[model samples]
Target: MKYCYYILSVSLLILIFSCDDKVDLEQFIDDSEELTLVYSSISPQDTILKVRVLKTLSSDNNIEINNSDAFVIPNAVITLSDATNNSVRLSYNSDDKNYQIEATQLEILPGATYFLSVMVDQREFTSSCTIPNNAVTELAFELTDNLNNAGDLKESVTIRFLDIPEASNNYIVGARIEDDAFDLFLDFENRRFITDQIEDGALLASFGFFNNNPDSVTDITLQVANVEPILYDSLFASYSNKENRQNPFYEVIIPPNNIEGENAYGVFAGFQITERLITYQ
Candidate 1:
């Protein structure tokens, strides 16, 4: 597909904070309970499934403290089964902390139901959802015809959504781009940075880059997650008010485009309960 070009300016700033004066507290604290796995492909209609695991801080009475050392279930074994019960095992990538069932592992026919079974730390978690028939989302990137006084490419690209509701308050957003000729998932914390409220029935944002050669964009894809009804409503207010200035999101710089050909990008968006979402409800 041919990419589009646009010109815009985007600026990023880093803020730091500090606290003083401490109160005495207990030296020992109990660890939080293991997170329960909530499995589903980011898009129910696609064979390329994305799964998420989460646990609430208040779920277990024995677990009282906040946060845990283990963000991801290590060495977890995950399997995906189609409507016919044919299954395939997903490989766990420690660096990304996700059990990825590649597109080649299973052929997802439109309208088929897929089940995901996860085993981590001796606990079993299972869930299933149907994939939608339409395309999950599309991403495009291009260089602006405009140039700075120094003759550098001054351009920005806005990844847009199709068939996504503009009034939808509940969603998680993510994106993946081609790196080293392979699709590398962007870190969750970093992807959160690009996230913002979808106002007036549409979600729109822009990212600016400086380059002498505008032909360097290999690929870009944006993904949106499902927001549970309750959590979705809360975000409508929180994001609208901007109560927290902290950008839980992250931005990664992709080195000049080294990949070639109609390079493809993937967006992984899913619905899973998070501690914040659970507690707020």
Candidate 2:
């Protein structure tokens, strides 16, 4: 009788362990698989739209579908709105990973507001920007024969407006010379100036009188880089010898957007008189 009772207790213990194991298995089976989709708009401000879609694994269960591969949505729809509140639809480009909208459809204009909205996998994301007006300040280097001028020479000749000043934010300063005789664009690639938060200050472009060209007056203009109004007229103008123009000097003070308004901002514009222009005497 004693042996039978011990055997029965062991059997009960085994049954309890087996039931617990089964319960865990059922819990695992009851869990549901989850799916998520992500979308990004590369050019949020321009009508020439670009978007990337990604589908990610959201569940721990082993699913049979190929999650490693990126499924292209050929029929994804995109829309862009202009500053005038007009919106146009864009079609997906089958040849690439993005959907492109025609620039002509939006009638991209300077100082116009714009926004981009993308739909992928039933999820939507959007961004907006007021197309910056053509805000450029003119800079000219006036060389004087006198060498006693110190403060004037130390001053920055190029004047520009800062849109943002957070660390790692990049700003582009551009200059163009426009005269009735010649409309010249400076070589920004060879002459473009860039500043970072580490070198915090108002946006400026500087040219020293020490480089010669005493009478040259540079008509300067500054705009946000890569968005509109081709910074350099052409690749050739980047290195051309077009003479600087005088009169109708360009200057404007742009109030920073809300994001950039907190910091102290001012326009730094000045010129220095250096050595006389030498003609290879």
Candidate 3:
């Protein structure tokens, strides 16, 4: 039996795209942290719509996470709605193992806010986010001749984006170097969560990727998302807590969720993503 497996790594705290994080879902089956995880993200550029609804397992359960009968939520009343109250009902497609509606069925507006409601059994989960306008003024990749601390020669990319002018604007930036199946994500600072609270205007960020042999690199991808402020806070707190998790003095902190309901835990946020690809120079 095949199941739609979406990997969410608690240890690495990976959000999405250009990442390869490995973790056994069964290992996180502690009864204490058990809950329903409804994860979804929307983009106008998507070719297929997808969403995940999963139930965590108990410590005593020996069933495999993927093939478990009770793991996936087969019956769900999934709906996506806008502020004006237009809604689209999504059905569980067993072929893809997710509740989805074809992209052709609905017209999604760029930089527009939308809401998600997932009804499972007697409970309902809800969350929403605004897609960013993605008006980037300047996006350039810079490669330097200087060697990194490891003495390995490498290249870096710098992005200067016209900040989304909002009262409370927040973003998640990710960069990775790729060549076919192999991907080298810029670590030590992967997926930097930032805000424009202190900014006067526009923002700039940079990341370096391993490139001992420049010919081995093909292209670099930069994914910049103007995520919701609520989603921004949750992601920031989650990674911050990871640093202190080993400290005996610190209390365990479960990252806050935007989804509102009993036994509902996870994010249903949309991404207004602006991706730029730069060929190795």
Candidate 4:
């Protein structure tokens, strides 16, 4: 497969290191009540929104939980309420082990908030997030192998767009490159966060980066997403924990934002996405 590149920024790295991990050893509390683990994210652009629900692992049952059926919570009731206050319950597909609801049923709208609730063993997990009102405008790109200020040979793509002035917003741009018969999806590690602090709402934003593997990119399709802060924070913590697995001093995973309760873990997020395709010449 060819390579899809995501240019990472310093702020994104900071977020990943800052948030709490969704899955980590610290969450394995000794309490008799099994803490419910939840993960879900939704977008108007998605056809199906899925939520993964699981119980915190215990010392004795940790091995057992590793089995597919043993870990998955069967018949869990997952409900999603739309901006109109209408609710749609997600059905559990035992085959996929996820609670799923069709996107059309949710009626995801811009600038609207959506709520998610899960009933597991009589425990109710609830969380809410608003969809940001913005889309990638004038999205265009150009590839170059030009030398930077450091005078090193750098192959990069210049991604330019307009930032909508809203409360504070975070953005991630990803590229899937097609070369020969292979289609390579960009790795999440390459995701960068775009913040609108300085310009407020008046600035043109451009994100560009040196290609890590230039030869692997021939044609690319870029997906720019305006992500909710909670979603961004959750991914930061979750991905950070996964990336630091090789380190000896691994910090416990910080639990994700589960609005259901303080100890609840996982994300209920929304994204507004815009896509553009550019072929490398």
Candidate 5:
């Protein structure tokens, strides 16, 4: 059974360019290949491993990529192993179209390395990532007001955290409303990545939060994620170069993918997130 498989990693970017210049897109479409894409991120807080595998599609294809079954690769052999040689092979769940490890034997811990391998179409592709030790010692938030470009008072948040350097530690912080009150922002917003290049051990880090709601009162959860160096670099590229995926005038930037193999892109990352809920009025 041949299913319409749109690689999730590549599909989102391709759709942004579908209505743009067809002449340029023709070359990209023609150059497209059926590459095996692997995207998985694991954390100890989560119960099961959710891995997505898909094949790339052409820009000219009319299949709706948003369809639940749009680009799912079924019944692929997938395995994940940690540095201590604790490994678990995943089984495919047709309902969610994701490869999952149900036994929960794998522990995603800081300073641990994880390797993921996928067997598809007679090709074996692999990617590895390490989990960084917890760097956030303490976290506190304060409300503040800032003047936007229009000279109007805008609400913002001030976040402060104590850091413990862990081999060039990199961090991404953000906040989101706990409930479904505001549809303006995603569950996680105000995303920013920072490194301890300037601030060393026992350093104090502070930054202003990017809040969309000006005067709204709600409960917001702050997220502090300790991302590995490799994964940090890839996310940094994806976050910084987001415009490359859009704007028709500039060439799209292919966000760094840690996967190792021919014609494949994506990351197998591990994250340790610490959250604190704050009531703001």
Candidate 6:
């Protein structure tokens, strides 16, 4: 697949890295209780929101992604409650093999807290998460047509956007490029979740580089998502674990989960997305 690029400012990088905590290994304890294994996330833009009820994993905690039935919970009753306190009972979609309800039936809004409950075999699991407010404005980007170091056609970029003001808010940022036949996503090793505590709510700038194919991009987009704490912490820790896998001194960090139930495990959360797109000129 073809590739696209974006850059994080050097000063921002320094500030972000400075938050690297000195984790004391021996002082850490595993007092946290494990809960139910279910997956669910809601967004205003979704046509159909789905909640997957998963089976318990093996002793080694290994999951087989391709085996649908091995992990799917049978006869689970799932319900979603919106901000207005209206609850909807989701139906199991045989096609998708998951519990779902149409987004139109339940209007979800940013800054609203929602609750998810699942019942399986007389046991009930529940969790609640707040959708963060979309505080980021439209991302401003300047693109230049160019040939990358690989001699392929590419576009270079300079991007700017406003920071989310709340320190509790952790946002995920990424870029994507698309053509009619294919789309490419961007990820950086140096950056994953960004929260600017030092210059919260201030305008921030970033720079970039990319590789090109199909000669040019048909469209490009910037995705900024502000998410709640458990979801943000879970994703942030997962990203760090992936990046540090090659280092000998690396310690694996478990992603924080919010689901609550006996003999269950997993997290349920929501996302508020802000996206801006630009077509090739």
Question: TM-score for all predictions?
Answer: 0.42, 0.34, 0.74, 0.71, 0.76, 0.72
- The residue-by-residue lDDT of candidate 6 on 1-281, one tens digit each, is 22121111011111112122221112112323322467676766567777867553332334343444555666899989976789999998776557888888888887788899899989999998777666466788776554544585555665677876665566666566665554334433235466676676877654345433534566667666666666667666656765686899988887676788886656677776667877756
Deviation from native of the Cα of residue 117 in model 3, angstroms: 2.2
Better of 5 and 6 by lDDT: 5
Task: Give the per-residue lDDT digits (tens) of candidate 3, residues 1-281.
Answer: 22333323232124345532322343342235557877777767555556767776663565655554557778988888888888888888786457788866656677788889888887888988776555344456566543556786556555556676654567777665666654445542433666677874656564555534446667767666666665666667666555566798987556567788887777766656667887866
Summing lDDT over every window of 10 consecutive residues in candidate 2, give the lowest-scoring window.
4-13
In model 4, the clashing pairs are 20-254, 21-253, 21-254, 126-260
Better of 2 and 5 by lDDT: 5
In angstroms, the error of model 4 at 176 is 3.2
TM-score of 1: 0.42
Any runs in candidate 3 off by more than 4 Å, and if so which?
1-16, 20-34, 63-71, 91-97, 133-137, 145-154, 176-178, 181-183, 188-191, 211-215, 241-253
The lDDT ranking, best first, is 3, 5, 4, 6, 1, 2
The runs of at least 3 residues in candidate 4 whose Cα sits more than 4 Å from the true structure, single-residue gaps closed, are 1-33, 62-70, 146-154, 177-183, 187-191, 202-219, 244-256
lDDT of 5 by residue, 70-115 (tens): 5667968999998878899999988757788753678777777889
lDDT, candidate 3, equals: 0.63
For model 1, residues 28-107, the per-residue Cα lDDT tens digits are 11323322434233333334454444333332234323223233345667787888878898776665445666666777
How high is the CA lDDT of each candidate model? Answer: 0.38, 0.33, 0.63, 0.61, 0.62, 0.61
Highest lDDT scorer: 3
The regions of model 5 sitting more than 4 angstroms off are: 1-7, 10-30, 93-97, 148-152, 184-191, 202-217, 244-252
Candidate 6: how large is its RMSD? 10.2
RMSD to the true structure for each prediction, in A, is: 16.9, 25.2, 5.5, 8.5, 6.7, 10.2
Give me candidate 2's TM-score against the actual structure: 0.34
lDDT of 4 by residue, 1-281 (tens): 22221111112222212111122322243455545667676667777777777655445544532354545677788888976779998888877677787788878778788888888767777888788886656576666554554686656666667787656777766655665544334433423456676777654444445334445666666666778887777656656655776899988566456567644656677777777877666
- Highest TM-score model number: 5
Which pairs clash in model 5? 5-71, 6-71
